[model samples]
Target: MTISSAHPETEPKWWKEATVYQIYPASFKDSNNDGWGDMKGIASKLEYIKDLGADAIWISPFYDSPQDDMGYDIANYEKVWPTYGTNEDCFALIDKTHKLGMKFITDLVINHCSSEHEWFKESRSSKTNPKRDWFFWRAPKGYDADGAPIPPNNWRSYFGGSAWTFDETTNEFYLRLFCSTQPDLNWENEDCRKAIYESAVGYWLDHGVDGFRIDVGSLYSKVVGLPDAPVIDKNTKWQASDAFTMNGPRIHEFHQEMNKFMRDRVKDGREIMTVGEMQHASDETKKLYTSASRHELSELFNFSHTDVELPSSAKTWSHLN
Candidate 1:
């Protein structure tokens, strides 16, 4: 494992000791009496963040989204939602954060884009469209041994039901790891990967934000074969098939490229701090992410503790031990 060597001259002392305050923008506070939190609301709370001993703030997604998934479905990458405020409002918030000696980080949802996004719209139109391959689309299996339209696999979505959504216009099933509207991008396509890496990360880096909190960061890549998953448990009538595609084959390679892109674009050699939201990562996965030389992720948000019922199972305790 190769750990990234910190350049003593360029590293920021604050990063090593930084305490981050995560602000769920919609619920944090409302400023304009609109009953929804916006940039102005965050700006109003800068002193509060500083008073809490945090050195930086990580704001949830505030981009133009349908709000179907509570802002997880981003409609535009470059512009801030009008309900949140203008781009200028974001700049103001950043300025206020820096004035209090706190760095600012924003959420980046790259694994999938809102179904309303232009790329997805185009991709869903026709198979021959230029952007059709931008997302994962597979022909529906017309017949199995029993003769029925078999889904691409036995994968279920995190929300519910099948992960493969049949598009009537194109007669193809597009893979949606999350909600039906959030189509998963095909990271295997170099153009698709490069476009996302540059547009999402590069645009923000150029905008002077300190860093990013990557959402669903591990689901960027899918197993190339797109094979059906084995049904291990039969107790539940409905089950989510996330295990089959969550941390797909090329996740590490994709992250390495993203890391290199980030490092190469740093203005003064300050390492870009990134925290990945890893939902079901095991101890081994955690180590891979945080290992010094992995080039995968700097830090990971593992929800293992949150999911476990404490003091009940010695086996769980043993797993941790």
Candidate 2:
């Protein structure tokens, strides 16, 4: 896809001309006719995708999960979901994809992990646990007249409820911007971030993964103080949270750290692509996110144009007139 430049000093990157086809493993192609697609099933259709003019395949989350939030809530980043096949099948698919001259990319759902995840399990087990700080657990704002505890804030989850979910064992609440089953990871903890990198990013990159489509990258770093969002709709206590969540202060810094790690892992000049998925970011923010000089990301998925269908007020994502 590269064109003739007036200056002859142009070097083209693989992704610049790559046509990536996204695959949802659940229904993409079925090999065993089990009514569900597996990693091998996707591997079987590589030639078809390549012939259709695709240079790369970006597969959605097939990580071990509890099938909550359509597998966006990952329980184990290192293991392939049993429904989608085993780890061997995933590795074989990666190898086959590379052999077919097509790059393989996988969705990185690092914004949150399944509540069933061991990290989350340990985090919620006790307030004194070493991993307790790995997640955003907050004390109740206060107790009501009846002595029932109130949530830390009025922030709304994207799935239409309070973002904070209470735990009976810990007597505290944990933040989940999306489904309650997906507890948001606290990237503020350097140890937590390192563990995530080892188990998720480093593990995959060490394998043959060519890139990652980072889910909800803009919401990675929330406002430090965890302030309540401004109220929008009068009828609902839950408030829109774009002001505190979207484009957090250290987003670029975090991305740069990831980019640096990716670069450091490079062997023989291989370029690993990274595209952040953020629907609410402005064009200016996206520019910085993808700027080569910034060393942030290879690209960014933004919905500045397609957001017209959304309401002007800071509401959770939904189709609206």
Candidate 3:
């Protein structure tokens, strides 16, 4: 059996034909030998990557974070993690990669950020604070017999616990789809999305990154009304949140908005590329994500069969439904 292009007349994107090299900066190379990799180390090896016939370099997150979840829990979107190197070092790496004729793609982890991030801090500061709406927060459903506050729903953290973490200061629970240290951002807030696009997406593009590898891309949208995930795992108090959070109601709208914002910043003579790490979305739904007319994504990494997060009983498509 063989497969052919359904749209042979469509223009081929550069990334479609280019070979890519994925780098985890923390352990890739350590220029200063602080026991961790830095931007300078990656920069030093640009020619080596090019020599290997890689047309693009995809670096994992090196953004400012508490490192609770490696760099996935971004603390500051605009700053580089100090051990990784300074902002100057990052810019130089991007410039060096471009001079070598290789595209640079950095991780964009917007689904959730570190609890220590300024946004999350301010959000958890007080319930009435202006930024409180920047993350998902819900009042306790009720108190249990032991007087402990129950989470708003039975959603489980990807790391294996309650998805909602109680905040004593605010008397509310904030959602953390991953770890308690990583608070999911509220994409429903237009202000938050605008600021994120400008600072996180636009700044990198302006400084010379060719594109981004969006992390947990399909989980951007939140399930409306904070519904409980189906109790697929009978033994656990919490269940997988994919049913509510993945490929959410506003997923396409949010992606299109971000895609347009990214495209509008293009200065001509330069083509921007993007690939999203997606999960729990159907093949038909993925078509909407990469459709040029839809302006959602250039490409997407589907985590269906490739995802090791699912249990054996839950791995089948029937279980997902």
Candidate 4:
């Protein structure tokens, strides 16, 4: 995949030449034939993957989860999902993949963790909980025309409805950018970031994982003050506003911190890759994200080309006429 350079000084890295195959573990293959694919199934397909000319494989989340949003709502990053098999099975698959000369990577869904996660459970236990600040929780802006408590802003969830969910016990609302069960993490909290690295990123990197495909990498930092998004349609109840959320003020800083950590992990010269999944990022942002001088990410997944339709406005898409 590398082209011959007349200067002979520039050469693309192995990853640049790698043909990566993405595997949705739940549906790839079923070794046990229990109607669900497991680690054993992945192991059984090494020959096929090798023959298919893949140099690396990116497996979707198989971590312990409630399956609310498939395995994206991770409850425990260190443990394997029961239906996907045990931790040993995961290690076995990694070993087999390495033996076959293929790199192994996994999805890093750090933007949000399952509400069932112990961290989230403690965060929601009390307003005074030490972990309470680990998530974005805010007071209601005020009561609506019907006297119902309104969320802090008019921001809508990616799935639908308001992004804020009221907590009965706390009498406050917590932000859930995707599913209500997947509460967004507060990367602003240094302790929270440290814990994520120790428990999620570092843990896997140390256990032989090549790298991560960071989920929602650009949406980690949100605009402070939680301003109401500009309403696109007067009749529509929800606002389609990523201006305040996507590519936030501290995104570069956060990514740099992550890059430093990853570099430190593989100081022994091992190749580690990181690709951020950023939706709606512009070409300029994409360039800055992947530039070596920026030390942000190895690459980025921009949804522009993949999306079948283009958003003509915030309210509607402009499909091919």
Candidate 5:
């Protein structure tokens, strides 16, 4: 499918006509029989990706990580995991992808890092550590009239239980929106924000990657007040408060900063494409995040379609018909 249009200036071209494929790397194929797929495996399969008519390939995370969250909890944003391949292997894959006239995009998870990550380890070391403020922390809400140690709010974690975990050494609670092993970084901290922005985007740009598919992109920033969420349902183990935390207040500002950085660094006028995965975004919210002038994202994946139960709804559909 050629993407040419008569009025090329006004065309919604490029990606619309490009065939793309997602490689889950781990399950794709194992070249050396190491029981895991590595860069060599992907390199060996480049011919197949090209022959299948894919003009671009979106690779799942292969960054240095603990694999606790399947490579989503990046320990080092600048390097590829040894299990995946060396830096040289990544470059070779890039060369191969480009040789076939196909571009490559990688997954970038910015919301949190593995507990083993240097930033998180140092942040949790002491209350007075310089990096402590790099992550969200709070003193245990001290005392009701009855003198009980209250939590900051009624925020529940996505994995289950409280979102705040107490650190006995520091005598405070650190916020982790997801797994305890994956600590959420404080985007409000300029240093933290700058570090993540540079590391995540710079690595790929340096490696000649075309773009990124930002995982949980909207979950980067949080509301300042950290207020309690009202109860929605008693039967559900999860709380409605999860929504307030997912796409928080300052997310747009963070994205704008990232967008500007990418735009400034683009080589030879090539546009840096970005796709955001936001869990509960509405159509208006999606438009706000992906608006061309806003420079937040090139596109966003909406979760509305997955919320439907087709088989159960078929009876209702029959009645309506």
Candidate 6:
């Protein structure tokens, strides 16, 4: 049996025809005796990647961070983490990868940022701060039985416990989907969206990054009002349903906005590819997100298979069939 492209008129980009290699920079290789892998190490190993038949290389986050989430929690969008080398090293890596005819992909994490970020710091400083709306901040749902303020909603954190954290200074609750240091961005705010686009996406693309592996892309646009999630189990801690958070109401709208930005910058022969890390989304949502007409993304990273696990008794030594 043979398979063919349904649309032969359209030429497939390098991404569609190429094999991708994902490398977590911290563990890939260490050029210096610095314990952590750096971009210089990656640049030095270009031949190895090329010989491995990888057409593109996607490196995990190496942005300036506190390393709370191992580079996922970004503090400075454009600056490189000092331990991973200077910003010049990163630029050189991109050049080296392109020189080898390999596309360079960087991880784009826009969903949430580290609390140490200037924007977050300003947002959390006071309720009257102009950047306060950049992140999701809301009043409590009134005092509990013991007079303690409850979270705005029953939504639980992705890591664990309540998603909303109370701020004594601001006298309000701020939503953090992941670790306390990683506060979810408010996509509803146009200013916030514009700032993020100009920095995270535009900054990298302008510097010649071939593409992006967007992290937690599906959790960008959450439902309005922050409604309570239905209880899945009485004994369990996390009560929120991903239905409202995973693929929110304006998800496509947000992606389309990003698509337009990318389209305007794309040259005639040079095309950029985007792959979103979509979690807990339905089949229809995935289809819409990756559809060509929708102008959202080129592909998606489906994590359904990651849920597979082995029994505790078989943990000693399990082999794939």
Candidates 2 and 4, the one with greater TM-score: 2
lDDT of 6 by residue, 1-321 (tens): 122466876556667777888888898989998899999998989999999988989999999999988998999999999999999999999989988988999999899999889999999999899999999999988997898998888877767789988888788899998878889999999999999998998888888898998898888988888888887657655565476787888999999999888878666456788998886567888899988888999999766664558432122110010
Cα TM-score of candidate 2? 0.94
Higher lDDT: candidate 3 or 5? Answer: 3
lDDT of 3 by residue, 218-283 (tens): 888887798987778788888887878889999999999998898898786577888987766788
Candidate 1 local lDDT, 169-261, one digit each (tens): 888889887788888988888988888888888887887788888888877877777777666445433345555566767787888889888
Error of 2 at 32 (Å): 1.5
TM-score of each: 0.87, 0.94, 0.93, 0.93, 0.89, 0.91
How good is model 6 by TM-score? Answer: 0.91
Q: lDDT tens string, model 4, 1-321?
A: 242445665456667668888889999999888999999998989889989999889999999999999898999999999999999999988889888888898899998999999999999999999999999989888987998789988988887789989988788899998889999999999999999988889888887888788888888988987788897756667676588888999999999998898889775577788988887677888888888888999888766765556443443221111
Each model's lDDT comes to 0.78, 0.87, 0.86, 0.85, 0.79, 0.85
Using TM-score as the measure, what is the rank order of every candidate, best first?
2, 3, 4, 6, 5, 1
- Lowest lDDT block of 10, candidate 1: 312-321
lDDT of 5 by residue, 36-144 (tens): 9989999999998788888998889888988877887789988889988888998999988988888888888888888889898899899888899898889887757
Which residue runs does candidate 4 get wrong by more than 4 Å?
Answer: 1-11, 145-147, 306-309, 313-321
Residue 124 deviation, candidate 1, in Å?
1.0
Pairs in steric clash, model 6? none
- What ranges in model 3 sit over 4 Å off? 1-7, 307-321
Return the top candidate by lDDT. Answer: 2
Candidate 2 residues lying further than 4 Å off, grouped into runs, are 1-11, 318-321
Q: What does the lDDT read for residue 173 in candidate 3? A: 95
